[model samples]
Target: MKITGSRGAKALALVALVSAVGACGLPRSGPNKAEIFKGSVLKQGDAFIVTVNSRVTRATAVTPALGFSSAFRNAGVVGSDVISPGDVLGLTIYENVKDDPLLGNTGQRVSALTEIQVDGAGYIFVPYAGKIKAAGQSPDGLRNIITKKLDTQTPDPQISVQRLAGDGSTVSVSGFAGANGVFPIERPTRTLSAMLSKAGGVTIEPAVAIVRVTRGGKTGSIWLEDLYSNPALDIALRPGDKITVEKDTRSFVAMGATGSQTKVPFETQTLSAIEALATVGGLNTGTADPTGVFVFRNEPAEVANAVLGRRDLKGDQRMVYVLDLTQPTGMFEARDFLIRDGDTVYVTEAPFVQWQKTLSAISGSTNAANNIATTGQ
Candidate 1:
């Protein structure tokens, strides 16, 4: 370990060069504590950085409310047996005459009429009954109308009408459903939950599955599981309604020195900071600075005002929340802190990491110099 003046000076020179290069730049997962603070609102930066506290956690701990609007909730259950236009009706006529029957041959007192489709104008035609409105009329109501129409023509005409298949009282189901098709809305499938069951239920995980209902140009969505927990969410189905079962598209970006950096999806309806971190495999034990955990989000003006206690900020405000896991209540705050969709969770590297990298560079440089000198000798 004894080095002469020239060799010692050369080593010192190499160390200085490495230190200068390290000071200039070093690879990092993301901006460290100092760099992040430099971009704070106080520093005239775009982001407003605030330390995570009980108030901050409470202010930001919110998930989107997944439920139906008044239009969807206020809709009353429809009668599944009600007739509508485009419906197929099966009719059978019974005659009391022993001689000549209006709809059958002599001695034959019965006549069958299959596929009597209701027109777009809600009219259905029987042989002698003429055009009769069938839409909005129940099967029995239509039967009575037909009998009355044929009363003056046939001998005590009796009629029976039955609903067979139709494009009217049916819903179109698509997306993650087990069976994606148009299903008839019958007595058993009159409600949202029942209709979903008729479609073979959702194929995705229920915890994150979303059911969207579109009716008359208005759309409402709710968590598929919420349909059971909240009875109001299971609204009655209507004809021409479109239903889609989709997986939750909400996700957060995981970056910096923690686990893996990618778009982490929401596993549950509501996600917290702790859960989000866990989803990304937690922090990198060696490089992650426990005190430099941060979350970046663009919050609405209303939420920004509540969090920062300011009313002047308008539009979407850039918010950066700092979490010091080393504090006594830090872990609790993280557990309570909600991670909204499109948020980012980042952890800075420990300060000593840069120094270690600098030292490694210097050692590598010195070894290379020594090898060159030995080779020359």
Candidate 2:
């Protein structure tokens, strides 16, 4: 069949019109490189960068129960006695007697003034009163024995015992503070707050502020929130007590299709999957393929195999948990999934969207070439 020039021109015009329509059907591409669809598949190593915007919010703030009780039991005695060696005890003696000028009121007068030294055996040496166990004894208890011994030698004598040296007065302050060391509590009554003040207070950064108290070898952990909310937990300080404010160590990494691709600090030991998502600004709107959200975490090989069918060949390798956010039920389940420390969250872009963008670009180039050719003729 011999084709006419006008017919050929009409056919070419029809083909161009059809191509333009098909190009119009192709998805428009802008700065956004990814799209969230109902059912999108993702492959490993695909990069999707999340856009930064003020509208995006993270779930870094935690509102835990204020009245959470500590696991420590109140077993120790209140105001327990603590005595150590090298403690000096001051003793004074008074007596009632008439004055004899030459003898200096020898019958009933203040005769002996002595200071006792606690030896290594926890015993104190006193004049005329042999070794006395003063370590566990109260002031009055030791005075009674000294007075009795003085009575046998002389008349009735009154003895007073006082602590003048404070060698054993010390408390340990540690953790998220400018200064962490063993500080001596100069005051008779020292509280936990006072110790923190002396140690330069808590760290200004919330990510590193955590205070823990250990008294007489017992451990108790307290959050910075508890320090402000629950004052009752911030109890008074005692001798031989240690206060530590440890820097928070648990954190999650947010990367790939998140506004902020960095480590997010968490106060709690474990963070929920939904909470982690929120911390990363809840995925990029135009670029994130929610269905491709995944979390990569390291776990024990045995446990990983039991839970995720992963083998031990990788030797402590991380397990990948892929989450399909397209399904309505995925939202609920995602909330239950917990994220551990060092876990990485990634959101990918839809593959078809990229194809559509490529097709659109190719069609646009073809149209530009056609227009240039027509203008040149």
Candidate 3:
């Protein structure tokens, strides 16, 4: 009886240690990441994804969400057409015939076109027009001013004012452009695409190119492809606007029981959830919980706060979006659902996988106990 008691004691001790270790080694149900980020979990159908337009109505003081088309238009260099300092003007004056000096005029029909530059003080000096304010003055307005002034010295003096572009307005295009440099804006109605083309076109593919524009300390970006898709957004450029073309290398990570766990690049401007899953090779048939497809993202601060009706949220606050691919509607919805930058697509293991793991743990514990029993005897 004493020897039997000793064997029982050894078996119990092994079982306790094995149980403790197994508990420590096991993975949790959801990703440990969300907990680490202290984010909120949102099941599908529980809350709607706040879109750009909807954001305007729901906003309570966070940075307004950027709409897809508005990003291109709002960031694009556009404003009232007005002349400014550093603009070059072509001036032409007419006088009565017989002034005859530069043209040895038999009669003054038309003088040679004179090029004038707007001084930093916003003034332009012309022979007859003399010290006229060019900046903030329209081409037609300056023409009238010059005509009125020149008429004092010459008969019915007519004047024409043209904006000489070379020395005037220009835009800077660099990064991923074949020929990166300052491109002169010839027409007042030059579009973003035209400016890029004038700078030797883009070296990167437009479909995946992220074009960023910066002006007056404000910056915004849109995919080159998306910009072209919307006609209203292809706005005119303003002088001094900086356009930067960069590769759209943004990606999302896929983990859990997916067929291939990897970081998938967007490759294009927009990617739906279904397309994202397909890009990462989809879920593993043997172990994936089809019902547990989840996308973890640090949603826009405004969107998260609106959904939670909270004060404020961190930029890194994680939001878990569940998808049930087992149903047809779920698949359709996934097709329309857009995947954003830095999102994580995770598919949890099936419930049976946990059972299998539990059984394996039990088997290991039984073997450990048997080994302890033999040693004890």
Candidate 4:
């Protein structure tokens, strides 16, 4: 097209403006595939970039293996009805002799001791039984011992011992349980799962719930859902054990051209790359480059070696894995690929998105120039 008069000058100025915008580069969601490749360790960058493939997917498909250790699983269940220190025992003694009963008056043949508490030293003192070891003995066994101890003092002494309000043989259940309190260990609540039930079960979703058992100085954790599926994980509970039901704390970050950029927590026990994308609202359809999906993570040396097929890498290695959804098996690879905690899932913008932005800037400049040219006319 031929331009004349002041219009020609405005046209030239418009061309210059467009050139300036292109030279400065248009704003974009993130670096494109080529730019990302330029940042690879092979190209003097800090990250070792690898493409997502079936082999890579298999190598990186590991999830957090959470379960009770042998220390917890091998523990045998103790008798929940056994007496322990700090337990309160209710005792009632009956004497056959009506004349001058040792533990009762002449006319009284029954003596009721409603509050006999086992001391910290595992001993309980009765009126005529002296200091007797009550801990580790069942209620019936304790009754027999008390009866024997008072046999010499009273005639045909018969004692009955009943456990009332145990304080020692108990577990403390807290954190996301339906009820948070110290629960006495009974026959029905001797195992870890049973103790959790005695506390009214976990209040949160089982898939994301974590059950932790802290006994003595060691702590073991397991997924709540696994407790039922794997009976071996339903470890036996011990006295003074503390059980806590908590939500899973694993999370990943979504950035770049994704539907939303935020730190998303794992809703299920195991999360894959595709599921993680869905959790963040998926990719930005208009700007996202389906071939430029990237996951950034600091992998341990062993994982890094397996993924890279190299054993030279040491410590935690910075790795970037690329996923191309445009490929035939790309979707399957993404579906199989696992997303771990603290990973960053980024989707770069399509190459044409930047070109489109540049065209928009040129369109604006053309309008401005035309208006100026019209005024000059």
Candidate 5:
């Protein structure tokens, strides 16, 4: 990290904190004093460029997002769009001939359909079979179980079970929606993107959304951009599952020599430094110190220290991120540099410009002195 002024002291302190990262988990001070970084000069490799997984590490849940995965684990049942526990199912038994007390001999081969509620236990009580596990089980599984149970009493007994209510035909969608509720699924139109559309679609752009699925106590998450890009992940929704959509909080701040210095929210959950730079209107070619573009962020001391090529130093540390954008591979490397939330990005004023301004001030002062003498004469 390169520092030109009193900021060098803070930069070294941060470097020391990372170098000492191995010594222990020393509590570091927060950036409460604006002066610590208010006018601090930054270089390309300061402790701030992000290299972790989460898009926004320093984000304080600013417009924070919440998400969940589907509630069923079985890929089989979940895929087939079958009903699970907490759902209503309808069943019918069929026999070859005459009226049987079990079938109530509807004269026809098939018995009347009966609707039953699947309890929280995922079990449904059949007339003769009593309570049987139904949650996460497929329609075929239910049919086979019921058939086996009645096989002994009747000759070649046949049974049919259909998912009446539950994940079988509906999925609950919530968040940033025109109407949040369970949407009935149309056959062949049960994918996530399709389901969201069925609910009148999300109000915000899905590409920038954070979506999660909670299923079987296990939750999975992905950005809407990824979901939209990957067709396979929009898996079938199982009964008893919930999906939540939320606005993306992942963002970064652009400061120093940019067209506009401001906080820029990521258009998509995942973005690169180059993309981030582009989003903020790039640097001011007229005044920006090209070599001084830097990103500032707090990072895991151990990891930061490891990258800086040293052993534990002391205290806590935030990184001063830099890149030699002039290099041929600069753009490629920048593309790999992921920007996190609350990250401070700055483009230093060119050294030549600063010198020129100083010289101009000196020349103006001399001219004023000469002019005062002439006026007095």
Candidate 6:
């Protein structure tokens, strides 16, 4: 059959349409279009950077400064003294009497009476005396009171009183310790580091250890790193002060064009989004779509709902946060966009570029097959 010119043109057009359709239908390269659309908006846009400026604001609640305040309160000054129960008092007696049995027994008698404890009302129960308020009383004041009381019973009774326990003398150790409990101080002077050693030092990684001290109901935090460098911050330990050691375990998210796109452990205190990108070995230039780099972060559903004035988000619902890195400002923002633990970053591929890859792969396969056929023939 002789083909007419018009008929041949129609057939060629039809073949071309079929080839075009086949090329379009070939598996798309890079990220799937559907997947990119499903991802957060940030992943679908160009990459940009934004700079972050920190603003100073007064702390509304207890902060690191509050901790320092508590430390100062714990360390009692000259006039303001802190007295606890079970504190020991020392006493000496002087009497000029022949064959004084009372004087001979004075040492043992004073020892027993000095060990007496102060009641919850801050009053001590002296053996031969009634309740005596000792909470705010100085050692010498307490001694004078005792001497006056004893003088009424015995003529010219000489008495001396002194506090055996130092003011501010108890230490408490909690969290990540072999034996987590409070310990009594036997001596007057003790350092913060010494108390920590006594309570069994941190068992967890030093880098992850956080030490907090609470005194007089106030708290202060000291990082392990700072404690090592600044000896001044390691203030002397006082009685009734609590030392808490906690372990920090939050990680960072790594996304974009990298060997592995997943969450990576971030042990440091702060992790910038750019640093996270570098951690994953940066973007894969060959297959990466620089314009479509983004980070998808889901805010706490409750927090998002509260901020947006919406009802409770479903259990599976996520608040999508899109970050574009194509613009220079976007890059600055990425640097400031702190990559919190468990955030997801996505990098999308260009549609046209993916189409080219698909067609290239198909053409390469077809050419290889034709070569094989020709060789076989």
What is the lDDT of every predicted structure here? 0.89, 0.61, 0.69, 0.89, 0.65, 0.59
Decide which is better by lDDT, 1 or 2.
1
TM-scores of all models? 0.93, 0.62, 0.63, 0.93, 0.60, 0.58
Off by over 4 Å in 6: 1-81, 88-98, 101-103, 106-114, 119-124, 135-138, 154-169, 176-181, 185-209, 212-242, 300-326, 349-377
Candidate 6 residue-wise lDDT, 145-235, digit = tens: 8767766655566666666643334677889755687675544236666667777778887776778887776678766656767666666
Q: Which stretches of candidate 3 lie over 4 Å from their true place?
A: 1-64, 67-83, 92-95, 99-114, 136-143, 156-162, 220-223, 246-249, 268-270, 298-319, 327-330, 336-338, 350-377
lDDT string for model 2 (1-377, tens) is 35688899888886676566555655432222233321132333323222211111121212322222343332332232344455567877775445531113545465544566667667876666667777656677778888787677555667888754544546777667768887765453355666687888877564446777776656676676657666566566655677777776778888766666788888564477778988778977766777777776665555444453336444564455666667766776577666767778777756555565665666787799999999999
> Which scores better on lDDT, 5 or 6?
5
lDDT by residue (tens digit), candidate 3, 215-273: 65767776677677877656667678799888877788888888788888877766877
Which digits, one per residue and each the tens of the lDDT, describe model 5 over residues 1-377? Answer: 35566598877865564445423432221221232344342543324443322233223113334333333222532345355556778888888667554656546677656678888777888776667888767789889988888777777878888877454456678887556998665565466667766767668987677777665577776677677777666766655457777787767888877778888887876677778878878878887765556777766555455655557745546766665577676667677776767788777666555445554554666699999999999
Candidate achieving higher TM-score, 3 or 4? 4
- Which ranges of candidate 1 are over 4 A from the true structure? 1-18
Candidate 2 wrongly placed segments (more than 4 Å) = 1-75, 78-81, 86-88, 97-120, 177-201, 204-241, 301-317, 356-377
Residue 190's lDDT within candidate 3 is: 70
Of candidates 5 and 1, the better by lDDT: 1
Cα RMSD for candidates in order: 2.9, 8.9, 7.8, 3.0, 12.6, 7.8
Which of candidates 1 and 2 is the stronger one according to TM-score? 1
How many clashing pairs in candidate 4?
A: 0
Runs in model 4 deviating more than 4 A are: 1-19, 375-377
Candidate 1 lDDT score relative to the true structure: 0.89
Deviation in Å, model 3, residue 38 alpha carbon: 15
**Clashing pairs for predicted structure model 2, backbone only:** 175-245, 176-245
- By descending lDDT, how would the candidates be arranged? 4, 1, 3, 5, 2, 6
